[model samples]
Target: MTDAILRVTGLHKSFGDHHVLKGIDFSVAAAERVAIIGGSGSGKSTFLRCLNFMELPSLGTVALDGREIGRPAGGDGARYYPEAELCAVRERVGMVFQQFNLFPHMTVLDNVMEGLVTVKGMKRAAARERAAAELEKVGLGAKFDAYPGRLSGGQQQRVAIARALAMEPEILLFDEPTSSLDPELVGEVLRVIRQLADEGRTMLLVTHELGFAYHFATKVIFLADGVFHEVGTPDEVLKQPRQERTRAFLARYTEFGF
Candidate 1:
């Protein structure tokens, strides 16, 4: 953990009266692929979003590459991060949400290029080149000129992946990237993500595809009611969990080989 690429300590998040995440601590070393699994309302998405300051945590600190982000505000003791600081963290931590979240009006290539040009401030031509390269990596180079509306759900998600990769993030966060895709399309997106894992890309993924997680993760964490119920290697956590909560959860995924 001392050499962790991304680390969280005492992480907590509350939405007004509802506490989504509570006192969670986690860290991933460079090139580690972490798979987080849990039932709905287990704070999985909230926890992932908090890492990038998208859904600000009510407490705790997140660090990237040994540098902690945010600071305590004087009065209430809640963490406060400046917009500039958050922007920089985002550039380092790329995220893909459950939904494709693509721009219907923009071509696939333009959608991928936007972050590079606007946020990274790269020259237009350079951004275009990088975006094209990333798209190619996701096997969507042929779809560059198509709009999100014109592509299948799987292809749209691939475009989202290309956009995230174009930023060259130190780590990638995937929040159920295939959740919205049809069953037939899920495999295509999983294949691309699997390829990234094979390449040793650092990633944290929240997914229900237990079979894929069994094969894809270096570490598997089981979250329950905002806490890590169990954490270990895929075989230990998924196949031979130490906690009753984790066992019950895995039982429901019997067909998935979890």
Candidate 2:
């Protein structure tokens, strides 16, 4: 039976006086693709970061495969995971950042293989093989030996995707995966993501690509003022959002004849 692969409950994150996320709650079924959209500072990125404990939540719980990750239970009370356990939880949820944070000093192949060998404990030979296959999947097989500086923004981002996939994560979190690419380059990255969804990889995406968000997502979430203002199927959320904030956000991107 299919199950919920990731669950966020009562998530509240704050940075001093600024509340970045306010009681956020969502769940991802196995192999389902979900997209999050909102205006700037709406806390989409912060929500993604909380998944892997990159940013600790002030209060809430994140569960993966039925296990409450990041947070731990003790005899007296509950606490976040220790650093070592937190590291293990992070490996299961791989993330690709908006800026394509690939190592400039490493070739594409090494960048992809680094996590496998270092974090996942795969042998170098085996990691290289996995990295190669991932690169090929992202249409970067020919660019394996190319350095980050030598490839286009789209190519570099593809390498970053490959690097995340090489870990064989159960869930992939993407923060504005194509936001930094040129207009012409956006299609390539989005196409790769479409292929991933076709293959049934669970994914959570935060993006401004409304067209892709509507077409590619099984579920759509609209965040506003650090809260999920709406959540529903693509047709419901994108085509007919019930909230005024969501309608307003979409209006800003609408093109109309003068």
Candidate 3:
């Protein structure tokens, strides 16, 4: 058995004739924080989505904890695991989207508890306890009864994070988690993520915050045109990139004093 917690090989995705991700391959080790960075239209989000099977790949293999997720049915098409297996995979691989994607009608606590109760079949009382603990982890315990509308963008996002955490997933995938927040609120959300990173939680984050990625990621991958242009430690990839494309891209950020 390999030490990799997640492994993706020959990943490819296309929208009709327009290909987005082109034969990508990568892996994440246990407790490793990997940050995927790239400009718009670079397939960063699509790559992250493919990991959890949110967007099915046109081709490739994705394995979590040594088990291959979707398998090839016949011909060139891929056959995803049955619903039961998929559900189990999803439960183990938690995802936090760019948007909060919370239920507006439910209170923060209910929103967090819903998955535990529904998917995990957890008792309401036990789910409530777990939900509250997760919310407290994100520093939102006091807002349990508050509706999403009553919370600030950062708070709502934290609720979403808590909801994912309540599942006790083995790995977390963050897709530009701070992109939609107001600049003032971005710091709060980043702090919560930073805390998770400090706790050695395995995470794969797609982010635009170069500084945060540099500080939080144990490894950094630079994606371009659906391929990994550079992959290395934060300092190696972000600061001393050897690839021309990677250097040019980082130069733009540096020019603006990022």
Candidate 4:
């Protein structure tokens, strides 16, 4: 098997008039922790969405473990991704959103178990067992029956993580995982991410936490004008960034807490 779990080549995306990604080329190895950081409109989130095929690329290819993730159907008429193929690819790539996208009508356990039963075809009892284990992994075993409306922002995010984990995905994508939390709650979420990294999970994160990026990231990439302008080891990119844009961005965070 190829060591690279994710391979994107010449990826491009545009939102009508705005070109979000301009020929992005990158590869992520198994169990690698890579952080993508940049200014608000640098296309970090869009790039992440493209990885999971939530936002299809205008021109490019994304492959996971040697399999092309999404492609158009050929003239023969059969869909290249027939619905099932797309679902399978999505299953292998679990994503945790900034809003924590939990179902308001379901309990924490139910939210986690729903996908397992519906997508993976697991029995209720087995799915619950697996869900419980995942909740426990995210320190949410006690909130299994609690509703999303009742939990704090941090706890809700933990449930989201557990929900994703229940599928046992090979790779995880975190889009601004801590951006929506209260100031004091960011640490709790970061702690969960840190634990996952310590356990050697393959993760791709888009975050503004420079401190965490400096400490946890195996590689740090800086985006500018819809492209990865700079990339290097964490220390090289975050601490002694060679690009002027990167240095200026860090300056604001350090001095004014932007």
Candidate 5:
């Protein structure tokens, strides 16, 4: 028996002949904040996507809360889980993207209520109540009626986060959540994420913010060339990396004063 909330084994992903992820394996315990750090083309985003089957794995098993997801049948890579099963898996694993991915046509409240009402079969009154609370959690209660177009980049991103939180997911996957914002706007989004971290929300994040990662992540995995070159506490991997590749990668960030 394992206490891990999520377990990924022998994960591999390839686009034609170009292999992006090469036999990666890791398990995330409940409430663990894992930061996946690497230079460009290191498969960080791909690895994150595979967790929720957003990008199907070429080979691997993903188990959440003890049950396996999208169990590939046979040796062929063509078979996949039915849409219904995938939907169930996704409901427990929410994602926040680099781009705010909000619906411009809908008000912030409507955007957050979409998944709850449509996918979760929530009633309008119930979903609206939940959506309002989620928005408040992200400090956006006042923007409920505002459209995405009316909000600043940071505000829009908070809407995105609130939308995900409205689902009450077991784990949150963040793919460079602050990357699309202007420099001045990144702090607000980061502050919200920090609050979630402090509240012990299980999260897996791919980020370039070294300072944030160092301060926020409980575990840091330094990936290079499709595999984790170093995995340890943030202090161990970020401050004193064991592998040359990990050291070299952090050195670049150091030069930039990150």
Candidate 6:
């Protein structure tokens, strides 16, 4: 609320006959960590994807730093941006996915450096230095030369995080960042994310980790049926929700001891 760094208005997404997101109006302030929680098929991932222009919204306006990203390119108020513009948007808004998206053939350091060198056009030596520093921050400095296949799930995910951080993005998006990791490995990844939050990185995360969400988020949004069903501070939304739908969702998570 201090001054929205990212804003979405009238957001909507559809895949043929299936409509996922419906008129979601939301915003995030600088250095604010926003946690989005909901049941499966709640459009959490699509909502995150739309922010980075990874999935073009059927109708909406996504603005970053007060500048709207896509333009009206066709009829019916349909909008989209060119790849060049979307690429520019992504440089400022980085995203990490559920699965560890690493290059199996590249060394850990190289995997982190690849985007810097290829996308940002930095020199290989400079990119290597930057990537190594990011890996060190994520507790993976010793595994610089190791390949993705040789690393544990947590380590691979840390590498993924390091890759995203090496870009020095203004905002980060995490979509179920630890969902694919072994139960034991989830903590390691979450710890790294917590460190990022403590360092004051602006982030929006889609997660089912309710307990962590309770502590990690500055603002929590319970998204259901493609709309924001509840939005407030963590305690307001997670610990004391007024909406019955939000209560039922939390009850289900509580049933699982979340």
| TM-scores of the candidates in the order shown | 0.97, 0.94, 0.96, 0.94, 0.97, 0.97
Preferred candidate (TM-score higher): 4 or 6: 6
Tens-place lDDT per residue, model 6, 1-258, is: 639989999999999999999999998888899999999999999999999988999998999878888789868868868899899989989999999789999999999999999999999999999998999999998999999999999999999999999999999999999999899999999999999999999999999999899999999999999999999999999989999999999998768562
Between which residue pairs do clashes occur in model 5?
none
- Which portions of model 5 show Cα errors greater than 4 Å? 76-79
Candidate number that wins on lDDT, 1 or 5: 5
- Please name the candidate that would achieve the greatest lDDT relative to the true structure: 6
How big is the positional error of residue 221 in model 5, measured in Å on the Cα after superposition? 0.5
Q: How well is each residue in 1-258 modelled by candidate 1, as lDDT tens digits?
A: 589988899998899899889899999899999999999999988888988888988888898887889878877758779999999999999999889898888899999999999998899999999999999999987887998998899999999999999999989999999999999999999999999999999999999999899999999999999999899999999888989999898888774662
Tell me which residue pairs clash in candidate 6.
none
Count of clashes, each model: 0, 0, 0, 0, 0, 0
**Evaluated with TM-score, which candidate comes out highest?**
6
Candidate 3 wrong stretches, greater than 4 Å: none
lDDT of 1: 0.91
* lDDT of candidate 3 over 1-258, digit per residue (tens): 279988988999999998999999888888999999999999999999988888888888888877788667888755656777778888999999899899999999999999999999999999999999999999997999999999999999999999999999989999999999999999999999999998899999999999999999999999999899899999999988999999988888879673
Q: Which tens-of-lDDT digit does each residue in 1-258 have in candidate 5? A: 289989988889999999999999899998999999999999999999998889988887888887878656787743476788789889999999999899999999999999999999999999999999999999998988998999999999999999999999999999999999999999999999999999999999999998999999999999889998899999999998889888888888778562
Q: Which candidate order results from sorting by lDDT in descending order?
A: 6, 5, 3, 1, 4, 2
Model-by-model lDDT, in order?
0.91, 0.89, 0.91, 0.90, 0.92, 0.93
Task: Quote the lDDT for 159 in model 1.
Answer: 94
